[model samples]
Target: MAATGTARTAVDSVMAQLSALEDPKMRAVNERHGDDYGVNLSRLRAVAKELKTQHTLSVQLWQSGDTAARLLALLICRPKSFEQDELDAMLRESRSPKVQDWLVNYVVKKSPHAEELRLRWLSDPDPVAASAGWALTSERVSKSPEGVDLSELLDAIEVDMRDAPDRLQWAMNTCLAQIGIAHPEFRNRAIGIGERLEVLKDYPTPPNCTSPYAPIWIAEIVRRQAGE
Candidate 1:
């Protein structure tokens, strides 16, 4: 009966693990900070691996069946480092705002898929995606010998300001403050957007849109551009 007892113990362990799934609130926070899951990668990968077989949990988390769960799953899955094709699938499939935030934020700082990012910035339906696209463009311009063309980027910003979501508009404006200053071509555009800072002071402003030191930066840019 020792073999039978071992089987029961293993079954019980699996059942207990299943029972430990987090409640909704905890899961939401986990989804929010999913990219920060630096330590939980192995466990998350194991769970994701099992879901590919079982198909229940992965379906609930990644598909339209449950947005929060889907978001958490992507957030959890994101840190494990997948192939470019896998990442493309996730980007194509994911529609969660949280996931969008993570993906766009990733593009701003990383360079693995440079051309793809530029394309997405130009054409993505989601404002966050577009905002991230421009932010990534600004980053490329800042570093590349192309020297960060202001006219096109500013025109894109103007389009976003008029037609895109406020979140994306705010993100574009914020990135403008930080990244657009290096090039002289964007000086007039920078001042023009900076002039509108007063209109964007309302509550719905995206985080980091208005730098605490933006006025100082604007003055500096204006002075430098004018040869003062």
Candidate 2:
């Protein structure tokens, strides 16, 4: 469906708000991450909240191709309204890791077809789709592991993680950590896999920050859960 006149007007207003709030420093930071626009999340969200329109305005804003506008579009887009092809297009168009992460976390995971897409994309040749699939799988593992085959996921991580694409490798590592934390049946095996893979083990985490190193992250969460 095409955006209506009202949607166009809302898009214009949002663009104006974004322009008014532009920060060169923030833009530079965003550019470093593949975004070209300067609007911050807080400001964009405030504008979205003020507009009180989600899908229609989101469609228009996404078409505008402003980095912040596209991010906001992800925030407001109706997940159910988007087809798998459209979601794939969005992933392909996402130039930065942040946008891709937001698309997975905010829009794709919320879709009614999330599980279907997750499974379909898991083995997809496209790196972005595969990475998103793993990310979605990780979210599922965290929220609801009852139906997931923990053994199968572990096998895939063990076999393919080392050679996977960069983003997919990150997601696979996260999936390993999530499996360890969320599924007691596979906790030991997950930790073992993490220790063997040694993924992100030397990534240098700051003080008081939990390392993304699967072994450490899993151990900490498991320890916390056990009240140790």
Candidate 3:
């Protein structure tokens, strides 16, 4: 509704047409491209040039069941120029929790408003949010210029560790071990958590291991932490 005015009519028309399309595959593919979406790569540039505003009617074309469309929307959606309310609105409508986490994770890295998004996400009811929180914590501790306190993040993560999905738990613990080995400052902290998880005692997660990353993930962390 608050979309830019100059392109209103054209965008509305496009939104209407795209929304009506029933072809799942084309919608999915086009959604990924966003403004750049076109049968030809050149058409993307032309379309983007024609549609200068951030929010457009054509984006609704993403409502189809096409996974590509949903993914593309996430790829093209930008929070830099968006107001806080707008960002919140976009996350709410996204429907895809992964995309929401992707948006949150993306903004936290580049936007000055990272803290706001982080706090909101940390408190989110979604398990993906908690899992994303762990991932974000790992990234911040590993890469943040300001340097994060691992103890604080670990404490928060451990709060709901029992409830996270197995895959998320595996990733969360694996990330912790990686940080421990890479950041000596947090080595003790990482080792403490990793050893306690006893990841190596169990089988590795399937694909990555005989079973899951849990076994080896936990074991490796404990071993490295103990200086073995």
Candidate 4:
């Protein structure tokens, strides 16, 4: 009972703090991405820094079902401590795109069980879970492409990217770009796959930001790497 009380008190305090930090404009932007939060990411990181790593408190915060709180939980949580099933459940519960992305990148990516979960999530019927899996795949493709079959990935992307749901499409696109950027042998082929599919080609991009269009994105990144 004492532990429960302490956890409850900590959760309430943090939730109240998050509520106080809400920004209307940030909330509007987040809402457009299927999330609802106003606490700026930098401010959120500051909050996490103060709390430090508290795995139990992070679990409690995660159970609260608030997007900002969940983000905070991820920041403070011990990444390697979670069981694979627990991470799976968390991803399933993550309806907010921001939460899902952060959970996969910040926590799951650092876990020891990353590969196991990545393989399972890749074949998951749920697109969101599959997207997280693809995000992991992209990480491996760029950093550790030893066992990754680049050609097979391209074949899959060529067939599926155009019809994939928003989240999965974005992840696959990242993988495609990673292949092109990291592997000289596959650069042309990756660009070819991207061009043929034309995914995100027409997507509006803000001024000065690189477009997500793969062929252009690949060439620009490769150019910058060679001191263009």
Evaluated with lDDT, which candidate comes out highest?
A: 4
Full ranking by TM-score: 4, 2, 3, 1
* Candidate 2 residue lDDT tens string, 1-228: 365666677778888878899999988987876668788788778876776647877877888877778878887778789888888888888776777888888888888878888998899998888999999899889998768888999999999997887788989999999999998889899999988988888988999999999989998988888899
Write out the backbone clash pairs for model 1.
61-70
| Superposed model 2: Cα runs more than 4 Å off | 1-5
* Tens digit per residue, CA lDDT, model 3, 1-228: 554564556545554543454356654665664422223323333444554434443254344433334434434545465565555555566645445555666554555656565556555666555555555555666567275656776675455454567545754775665566556676666666655655444653455343333334445655656899
Global local distance difference test of model 3: 0.52
lDDT of 1 by residue, 178-207 (tens): 554665566556667656554253435446
Off by over 4 Å in 3: 1-67, 92-98, 105-108, 145-147, 166-171, 198-228
How many clashing pairs does model 4 include? Answer: 0
Error of 1 at 77 (Å): 6.4
Evaluated at residue 173, the lDDT of candidate 2 is 96
Q: How much lDDT does each candidate structure score? A: 0.52, 0.85, 0.52, 0.93
Error of 3 at 205 (Å): 5.7
Writing each residue's lDDT as its tens digit, candidate 4 over 1-228 gives 998898899999999999999999989988987898899999999999999999999999999899999999999999999999999999998899989989999999999999999899986889999999899999999988888888998888888889999889999999999999999999999999988999999999999888899998999999999998
Model 4: what TM-score?
0.96
Lowest lDDT 10-residue stretch of candidate 2: 1-10
For model 1, give the 10-residue run with minimal summed lDDT. Answer: 35-44
What TM-score would you give candidate 1 relative to the actual structure? 0.52
- Candidate 1: stretches off by over 4 Å: 1-86, 106-111, 126-128, 141-148, 196-199, 203-228
**How much is the lDDT of residue 228 in candidate 3?**
92
